[model samples]
Target: MPNITGFLFLLLLLATEGSLGNSKNEVSHGSSQNVVGRPLGNSLNAWKYCQLGWSTYERRCFRFFKTALQWIYAEAECLRYGGNLASVHSANEYAFLKKLIHQGAGSAVKTWIGGHDAVKEGIWLWSDGSYMNFRAWNSGDNQPDNYKKNEHCLEMNHGAVQLWNDSPCYELKPFICVKK
Candidate 1:
């Protein structure tokens, strides 16, 4: 019943978001009267568009899931939200994602961020079909070494500050999702 109610409310918000300005805060899914957003006149900006549990950055909405899952399952979960795993394109964006993970997980954690070379070795691509222009690979020990010939998916916070390492797609790790 709660899921239905939340879905209806989300639909209503979507239908009226343009006219109602935009929601800027997390929305409660239950019968709480303390809702914050455009309708409640709590928006700090008139154009924010990310929903509850998602953080808006530069017109894109990002969500971090703490539940550990394999890379494929993580991407699938993101796809369920009409998006794919996040793709970091710049140092600032990567820092922002790291901050989001820190806030959500309470520490640095090995998390999935959608860079993979599953199809072709030595060629990485974002799962969202975006170009792979930036990389924060771990320089120590020479990562993405394809240890055991199974490392293909990208993960961050692996033994280095904000650095990434390649891991098997079957390994479980928390993930982040993004959408415009």
Candidate 2:
């Protein structure tokens, strides 16, 4: 009889904990709420990827371009696909991209992101001309240092642990694109 009561109590606790976890996830991943019914891909299968590649925590579809290109070219390529260069908004999104890049292109690989200060020095902006409020700049004493006064494009995963670095916009490098 006592064993039955203990088992019932354990079950109740488990259910309560599960509910709490789900609630927290929902609140944390509010962007995914609208993606519940979206199809992963089209019927033709022409696109290389589908909705499954989107991170639920970030609420954006990401694609990595293995080819290296200048910042302007990279941004143009992304725009052709109805998206812009990948703009990371949160730490979770950054971490997700870091892992994804490592899995897709190997670690220590530098990839062009959407951040740039081309318009004016010291004022960073995303590809869509949005102000950059979130930052994961490398504090390694040489990053965003604008070495030689020509570094304006933002590159991630340049150093260990996916830190952001400023590089010349003309430098060719692999890039990631993001679509809504």
Indicate which candidate wins on lDDT.
Answer: 1
lDDT score, candidate 1: 0.84
lDDT of each: 0.84, 0.78
TM-score of 2: 0.68
- Top candidate (TM-score): 1
> How well is each residue in 31-138 modelled by candidate 1, as lDDT tens digits?
323333422124545444456677877657799999999999999999988789999999988989999999999998999989999999989999999998888888
TM-score per model over all chains? 0.75, 0.68
Model 2 pairs whose backbones collide: none
- Residue ranges of candidate 1 with Cα displaced over 4 Å: 1-48
Cα lDDT tens digits for candidate 2, 94-180: 888887777778765899999998888878889976567689998874678889999999999876656999999999999988887
Candidate 2 residue spans exceeding 4 A from truth? 1-57
Q: For model 1, name the residue pairs that clash.
A: none
